[model samples]
Target: MNRLDFLKHLGLLSAGAAILPTNFSSIKQSPFTELRGGIGMFSMQGGTIGWYTTDGAIVVIDSQFPDPAHAFVEGISAFGTGPQKVLFNSHHHGDHTGGNLVFENDGYTIIAQKNVPALQRTAAQNSDNEANQAYAATTFENEFSFDAGDETINAKYYGPAHTKGDSVIWFENANIAHMGDLVFNRLYPFIDRNGGAMISGWINLLETVAAKANSETLFIFGHGKPEFGVTGSREDLLHKRDFLSHLLEYTQKGIDAGRSREEITSRTSFDEFPEHISPSNFLSLPRNLDVAWLELTNS
Candidate 1:
């Protein structure tokens, strides 16, 4: 099989997916998309993966799942060998960190927010999948930064949003930021209220991140509606913020008017965000309204 055929076999490229041009021909061989300045994105399942490959080190933002992670590991092999590998978990969600065990076995040092290990462990234990998890050994509370050759990686935690441990990993030199599950990009997000997700806080976090980014900065989102894709600009951030803000406002109004939870969550879709409406009620608008109502009433 040819290189394109090999990538398709690995499930990186779909049957009709277009292969965009990149400076590095090696990236074309696999599913890894080179954005700029050695930074790139890989999306297959779960949260999107951001990566930076240099002569000295290979840095990864999030791991999707064991199967995809293994495919990613094999795909990046074309970049050459003997580079230090590092994986950073965006949060403790199974979809994002499920591939931790795969990376752990391959000698990658995993890092995450301070609250991640316990959250990960608890989630694993609850699901009775503890053996499959690989918790982060090194963690930070507010911020963490490290130099990898010419590139510098910075991770920041802005309190609870998608999850309490949600982090934004920025590749400074590349001007690329990985928004983890924080900005779901036109998709109805998974609001992990049990894990400390707050719609108001999520809105604030997006506004702050967007304000900090310049026009040239590129963002890689954890998830997005198929039409929007996973990578976009700061406008996408504000678009998400608008969605969350509207969700809260609408829910708060419903509570003030003494609307029943059923009445409030009865709507299957929001007129403003048609893209976020899932046909199967998988991460549906009603679920977001339910979470928003609970949050507003402090229940």
Candidate 2:
């Protein structure tokens, strides 16, 4: 099966469903594969996780879920005796932060953008699953950076893209960036418009990120089509940017032509993005166009 189908089979396509308690015992442990300079990535379920192992500490980018998080902690112990562990949440999505409780209970320092806590709480409360979440103890407004042994880790917020609290975590020395859910790779992204996701801002943020990294820089994406994989370079970011741009342009044209909302959102594919097809009907072009219509009409 394709990677998107694999994700659907894992029951990860439904945002609300993912918040329900999962059968931890059924999950297989996912291993970390080093990318460069002690930095690596772990992928089992939910969003992809990025990790950094220093001489004295281990830094984690995003946590998938409690089960995977537990496996990650156990697996990383083989790295070194680094008692200082740091967790950075890329956003408030449950897929990324559901495992924060695992890290928090283990005495890890959890950090995230300032707006994450409120958004996280609201989401949990809405689902009546607040008991399962762990909020970040430390919060930053625009940018935050600190040293983890020889590596410098930077987290920065560039307005609202995927969500109001999305941040890009950069491991400076390793030249690796954990883009979180800001990038969906070749899949149709979950555009949380109600959660303050602005596609225009998202496109601009992608441009800023591409300009910040060089040709050699490596990026870990939250999700990817099996064919594309989860790790990529600057061009991948541009590809996503192009898709969002076209989405808006197409929706705008339909709106100007006095087409009905149903007609506009009924499209199944875009000639420019043939590879963007999603196996999950929830994330298909109709849903994306629905959100685009909402944004364009300011509804």
Candidate 3:
């Protein structure tokens, strides 16, 4: 029998694993990997941060957590004396925007989608930290673009995918797209249903965004499995799309068969799509299944 046939016969290749690296704390240093068009991605914690230097300005996308944000601030300062610093929030998620204060304190202009501040404020309030939270003062409805020396960085909202506030930050000259949590690479993704995530719509948006990108475009993912890392191309975006689509389809199929929430989500895995097994973000696959179930049945 063929490998696929043998797997079917043996009932092997069941569920996938969600694996988290055991050495997260050891990732303290701020490592910068250069991409196309004088842009780079930096990671300390919570979503990858994208930075660019071309003209006389520096732009940073997604400010990770507070401590890491401080490290990022110091790293960018060493790049040059470009006093014009701008920080962007890819969405209202704390991991991606918790460090807004790191730049705000230094007089950097903070930017994000219009819905971000409210979500940030609500999240802060939940933690009883509304008084100390840093939110983007500059907001855009759909598209925002600005020139920083020789490059024009652009931010555009694709309308409620990862979150209602999700925005795509693009380096125009370099063709590098910072997908935020919109593209989780090989890892299972966090479906922020509470934050207005639409799995079906999100799948469509993934294809929409992927369509805009060319073969040479370099995409930076918000998170990825330990082995996959956080950088890829159009194929990476489509891979994520496939995962979400399969999750939605699997959940709907169970629902159509009169399955309860637990009955549908209790499955060890979506046997049809086992490529995204990561014990690191283990909750994502099952959580996404639950969210998709609720979205299909309730909404």
lDDT of 1 by residue, 47-80 (tens): 7899888886888887877877898888877763
User: What are the lDDT scores of the predictions, listed in order?
Assistant: 0.81, 0.87, 0.77
Worst 10 residues of 3 by lDDT: 11-20
Weakest 10 consecutive residues of candidate 1 by summed lDDT: 12-21
A best-first ranking of the candidates according to their lDDT comes to 2, 1, 3
Name the runs in model 2 displaced over 4 angstroms. Answer: 1-30
Residue by residue across 1-299, what tens digits does model 3's lDDT show?
A: 66544422221111112112312443444467777677888865567889987556889898876777777777776665467888899998877887888779977899999999998898788878675568888999999999876677899998888888999998877888898889876666777777888888788888998999999998888876655778888988888898888888888889889988988887656666576654433345767788888899885
Highest lDDT against the true fold, candidate: 2
Error of 1 at 238 (Å): 0.2
Better of 1 and 3 by TM-score: 1
Give the candidate number with the greatest TM-score: 2
Name every residue pair that clashes in candidate 1: none
* RMSD of each predicted structure: 6.2, 2.7, 7.0
- For every model shown, the clashing-pair count is 0, 0, 11
